[model samples]
Target chain A: MSTPSSEQEVHEHGVTEAVISYPQFLWKALGVATDGNALFYVWMTALTAVWLVGINAFAHQIVQGQGLTAMTDHVSWGMYIGNFTFAVGLAAGAVMMVIPAYLYHDEDMHDVVIVGEILAIAAVAVALAFVNVDIGRIDRLWHIIPFIGRFNFPVSMLTWDIIVLPGYFLINLHVVGYLLYMRFLGRKPNPKWYIPVVLLSIVWAVSIHTVTAFLYSGLGGRPFWNSAILAPRFVVSAFVSGPAFIVLALQIVRRFSDFYVGHKPIVTLINILRITAVVNLFLVGAEVFTEFYTGGSHVAAAEYLYFGLHGKNALVPWIWTAVVCNVVAAGIFLTVDPRKNLWIIDVACVMTLFGLWVEKGLGLIVPGFVPSTLHEVVEYLPNALEWKISLGIWALGLIIFTLGLKIAVAVFTGTMHVDAAHDAGEV
Target chain B: MSDPSRRTMLKGAGATLGAAAFARAVAPITEWTNDLSVEGFLQKHYKELTVEDMSAVLARIERETEEQYGAKVSVEDVRPTPGVQFAYALNLSVCIGCRRCAKACHEENNHDRATNNSYIRVLEMTNGSLNLEHGTVTYDHAVPAPGKFYMPVQCHQCDNAPCVRVCPVEATWKESDGIVVVDYDWCIGCRYCEAACPYHARRFNWSKPEIPADEINPDQAYLSNRIRPQGVMEKCTFCLHRTRRGKLPACLEACPTGARVFGNLADPDSEIRWVLENKRVFVLKEDLGTQPRFFYFFDE
Candidate 1:
């Protein structure tokens, strides 16, 4: 709430000049997040219920052992690791907005770029949660701590992941937190404070996803993942899924709130998706050609994924579904214009999101181990408990994203400034 | 507009409910943690342990094994002998696919009785084909069924071990005697090593291993046959508990067909060396350049 004079000032200058201390800013942000409309309450409640169920299931997993999941020694890394890989791409994909907004100095993108950064933070949190749940010894997690634990640095790709994923999370958090705090204080954010970090985040985003791809590709034992093009495919497909998610998110934000998100940013995202989706398809085609054409013992896993190996084709349908979804989505993005046919863009975006989820999550990870290294065919599908844990992680991420957006919207719309409560005589 | 005291009471109630829910959500982790000891949680890596630290660790393990499995076990920290690098030579010509080697590994390593877990997997391949991709591990009819030759595979303990390289915590490493060993206490059980292993030699403890009291192997090495905690990776250490003490590996000793030969590679007169010199010998997946200490040979 604000008095007439302060409200006029906000209308004229887009902000009040009054600044608050850091702790006060955080306290006010928390207040803004907690205080929301009825829809916010319903959404929060739903997410909380799912998250609690997931937590209980995870606790059950911990008590019972990882054996409760469908994972075996043959397919040791399963849905948990699959979801982790996909979420890392989502986090990295959030940098797409950053590239246009910060690097190219696009004004429309700059206004909505904070939304992408917030999504990155939430995505990284989800990625870390999946990793935590997947590990066998959650209690012994301290063993990977760099100083105290015997961290096998410079050798283990996982250790590299441990470094980059958290590093990306912190970088995005710092950028988003600083910008929001400054906005809440009604002050113009200094370019020097966040510019370098923003630039670093763009590079760091690519590194996080690349590191994740390398985690699979670096393993020589699994020939399905031992390709040089895996990292490229990861980055390119991230571009597809990342922009698709942002497009859907931005539409939701525009519909729900009074924040002035123009069609320009949505068009920008669609344009990115158009190119990346095709490139992603090209990479897939290239990889498929390389695998099938070579046709050796190394092709066993790919054969199992695409055309069922030895009467055990659990993943064949899944891969084909991804291919169809991706091809159809790319076609829509290439032909349909978001300016006239906005609903069609939404459809295409959802399709790509599902397509990339299947492609990156199950289609990629499962095949790498289906025909085990010793040529034994052992198919894996995530059981009910694994699905519960994954859904819970998604719910937790949504909770973080929703709360973050609520606070950001309040600050961006000039409703929760430093001196507004004081001016309204409510302090 | 609302009453302040009533609002405070409501806030307190909400906080209490939240705490209860959080505690319930984390109950499994807490219950799991109850089995973990502070000393065990803080135990140093195998390479970092001092003589005193190792002795204390061994004592702690023995105590824990007694408490958990109800089996009185002697856990020893066996050091590798100098100038003695172990190599295994299996005579493919004599192997009949009885899977006695796998059974021997199960008993010798104190594997879970439910899974019948073992470090070795014996594949029955068609007579003319050397491709492991064509091999099958689940054949049930009989010993070396007609037109099939048996090949038993286990950890190669490679000079360039991918499992060792990929471990995020350095929990597994190759020792001086050309044997790869895992410090089960230190492994975070990410199973990255399991995925990196081409041999499918590594096994994971899906749950607490079940062994009857009388059947439990009492003679254990801290890094070898001792019962591993749930959710860690274990593999063949070439029976280092016995081999380091100048004894044969249980798998080699149990071979009724004399199919397996083991000895110090450094000793020129060793039987393994003689097999390598006299017979046509090869390592599995040699093109991967794992430089395996384990070899297979066939007589003409």
Candidate 2:
């Protein structure tokens, strides 16, 4: 995130001479020459270990029924689905960066942009993997294919999701392969593949989360999701969170690696994050007004989300926390002094990312299902297993992202040309 | 960023030409095609069933049932099942403020073991009131204890259902004997039908249905009783398995006061026909013109 943005600001215009920068302590993370794959391997091992332990421990309880889970019928899609939707949203957001950096000549975002696409792909895969884990039947995954046994393409928003996800998968596949090839050959990417797919990928990135929004909003009966605002909420949240997600990754990398991605990219990222976060902030306001202004089922749901209702308090705290965090973080991001202050920017990024994740993941889903779709107020609380699973998935995404950035950092700086040098190096 | 849901309702019901070749066998004249130019995969909604295709689809259904749910189910094509004609007439007036129908549906449909979801919902309404706007069909609280007449609603199985009308991908459709069924495998779980349905009869299996194998009903139809895949849309099939067996729907049998009347609407002499003729019969959201075969009437 910071890597590409700072790298991007330098040579957005005409090609200039390549000048190597002194190895400032801030520039070097992960001690110049550390093994990212080795780190990734250990992290991967930890993930596998946690997954096996949790499954083995809870095997009997799951078999007995979902009593072991914090979820009852009320909060049906609690932790597992929450994590699933969040990961999917992040995947959508990552592509938001991937498309423009390579496709268009957004040279500002040149360095480390491919990492976004890679992260996006891996994120979706991880989201889907969590879904399968939650269901505990990896085999039934094939039923989604229309030709395989049966696949009801009509009437099922999930069916649309099934189509769009893999389509996005294939599109990302080509993009990733192109980037990987470029990285391996130690040259710049060809536009032939990039140009033709660029427009579709942009629209497809929007479609991924918009479709996800529709998955909930299309349900007219679910008062929580039936808002005209759900689609917009998703789009804005994605935009606001996407940049911050990138920045957070960059900060984590900066703290650990020797990827001399300077402060310029971080500032550029901060500027974008501020604009989007403020826009997202306004949308959130409009959503609150539209929902409460109407004073109907949608209003009731909004109230349920913001404040407890009917002797139930499920997501009000999380929702308000997300709202406050977003508002304050956006405020901090927009303030000139704090926006420039690297530490303040990092704090804002963390807040925005956490807020958006809670909003899109937990807030969007739980309220929509609150008082139950069947109108039963079966509030969900994630059990240890649910938490373990949720934590496990989040950890997995971070690990994937971390490993991806490390490779990206190494490539762009050494074999990895400085973000400034890479585009001109090709030219 | 804000688009009006690129997914809108498009009735591809007009593509009966190029599609005629696909189902070149069974009764095409009367079954599926009715002067509609349905486009895309929606065009492949259903071709006329040949004896072979029916057998094939039925066989496929059984195999699917076995493969998906590990239940050796019998899927009878049952082109309008014999002997006891099938009809559903809801006595909206006679329906007490009880939810016996919902309970019955939960038991008979073999709903997911975890949630115990049902195909039936009793809209608790006021007496002599027709506006469903104020009605609350989803009641988690204990029911039949207040000032409300419960109208148990399920798939209307309409002659011109909005759910069937606007399905861009025809994963669901009305049968020859006036029943609507969803092919769980063919269904993408897009929930288009759930939205288009005026009665809100359709449900989506957000998670793979968890049904105890021993509790599974072996006599399943391709469109009914089979455990649905996660991410597909499904709804009441009028209990196809039992209806074809010359038996009553679980809801009809469950009513404590026999408030429901089940008989073939096609047969003029059926008791349901008698009720439809004698009583002031009505259907949910009649102005939608769904022409639901499920009629509602009050007791005299």
Candidate 3:
């Protein structure tokens, strides 16, 4: 553990004069992750169990065929794709913390910005998993690899997604890795390495969500998604979910750990949530107005989503539940002050997260295929296997997040550092 | 040499055991991969394959078909004709609600038996409307029910096909003959093309197509009616295997009332050209600008 005198010495010297090698730092990080409290072990064990169940379901899906799922020719993409879409939004939302911390130069935000980046990494991993599971032939995935495979670049928005998503993941990994490594060495981090990358990540984050929205909107055949406002709506909704998730994460970190998260950062995040939640609701209103008011042949999907079409109304309840959640959450965010009543903020954050998941995931992707292209209404609902698989993916994501946060907290708090044995030639 | 070497050996043994355990855990994936041959996995896209490569691929497919389905199928690599482009037209007034063409497509294209799958869906619509939303494919009553008319829809083989445009791997594309086709072997089976097509023209093979060995179509073209593998996209190719060999589509020949017209649009005297010139023929959802090669005309 670092003492006051040692901390003073580090500040004065600007860098640690005696530092251990990279390997030693990594060894220490592993220790930090593995050596945790009883609660951490239990949580990790539960997550692993769920993850195994998911893998089993996915294997069964592969063996039995995608026919085991509810997807048909009419509704070709279902739970996997819907979850993939929502996870991408979550990944994009993580940049909200980055924007405030880096652009605004808020010192308090800088202390906890790593949480958002780690979440981004976890979210992207989950997104990729959803995509892998959704694929009809996961073995033939190499066909889309550029040069080695016939990648339809520039023409296909999916290709753009393939490039940006992993690109964002790598970028965040580099930033987080570099920062943690510097902190482990008790050395001052050079802005040259991480600053340019952080700036690139912000722009890359927006591009990823925009490109994802374009994947749907570019399809002129699906008039339900063929709207110009979709890209902006994706961005705005991401802002809502991202900050709401961060606020909850920050609260949890503060409650459980000894890490010093100041009041200012939470307030700053709440302020961001206030504006984004309203803007998200406004975008939803605008989309609903345009879809219903026009009442054209294209309105069949929207009608199916909101008011039910003919006799089938599978999605009507889902959209309304999302609407109620968003409205209530946004109202709470606008009125309640986080300083006085913290539980209210937690409630609101959970609501917004759930609301946005439904809004962006099933509420968006399913409707595009309902009242399918030839005007036949073939409703899709994700079966039990799909739910089990989805739960497993979420568990995998939480595992990543938990392990990442543990290492980050350890490094940031000066509890994990390079062993002095490295300098003594014993390592 | 003493303690450290012993520890290292034990670590190696532990790693091997762990790897073996992991492999056993994922035994289902290993079992699934047994059906996928190394040659099939490494095969190139349809357009990129040379003559030798195509013949080899076609032979591989034939061998696989024989082995898997116990059927002796002849799969060929058929190319487009130099001076011909195909077009189809349907006489809406004459078309009865009976789905003989749909049935012919199912049998001719070697569709899955359990799903009773076909490229064509005959929508029974009310007489006073052209709106497809009001149309129903679930009608079970007698043929040509008094106030109802039927419209059979399939792949239009559109010149500007949304299905072709949205395919992330160029697995589906428009041939030089203006017919949209899918290289079923190359498709990643993301089904993006299925969602992109307004006609719902594309079908995904959710499971292994379960056609009996005796019922399998022996004359198969690699791009047209060859039975697709599970987890790929397939669509109507104007029965190009038959069409390129100077024959009409299976659906056209199967139509009871001569409602379907198929011919080379490049030929000035073709029947499809005469229909387009003489009748008020229109493409479905023309405002989307897909420029479909299939047309419909009502006898007024």
In TM-score terms, which candidate is top?
1
For residue A25, give model 2's deviation from the true position in Å.
31
| Global CA lDDT computed for model 2 | 0.64
The sequence of per-residue lDDT tens digits that candidate 3 reaches over residues A180-204 is 9888876688999899999999999
lDDT of 1: 0.90
Question: What is candidate 1's lDDT per residue for A382-415, written digit by digit as tens?
Answer: 9999999999999999999998898899989998
In the order shown, the candidates' DockQ scores are 0.74, 0.05, 0.58
lDDT of 3 at B97: 73
lDDT against the true structure, each candidate: 0.90, 0.64, 0.89
Among all candidates shown, the one with the greatest DockQ? 1
Determine which window of 10 residues in candidate 3 chain A has minimal summed lDDT: A11-20
Give the poorly placed runs of model 3, Cα more than 4 Å off. A1-20, A421-427, B1-25
Docking class of 1: medium
Top of the candidates by lDDT? 1
Question: Candidate 3 residues B152-198, lDDT tens each?
Answer: 99999999888887788999888888888889899988998998898
Docking class of 2: incorrect
Check candidate 3 and list the clashing pairs.
Answer: none
- TM-scores of the models, in the order given: 0.95, 0.71, 0.94
| Candidate 2: fraction of native contacts reproduced | 0.01
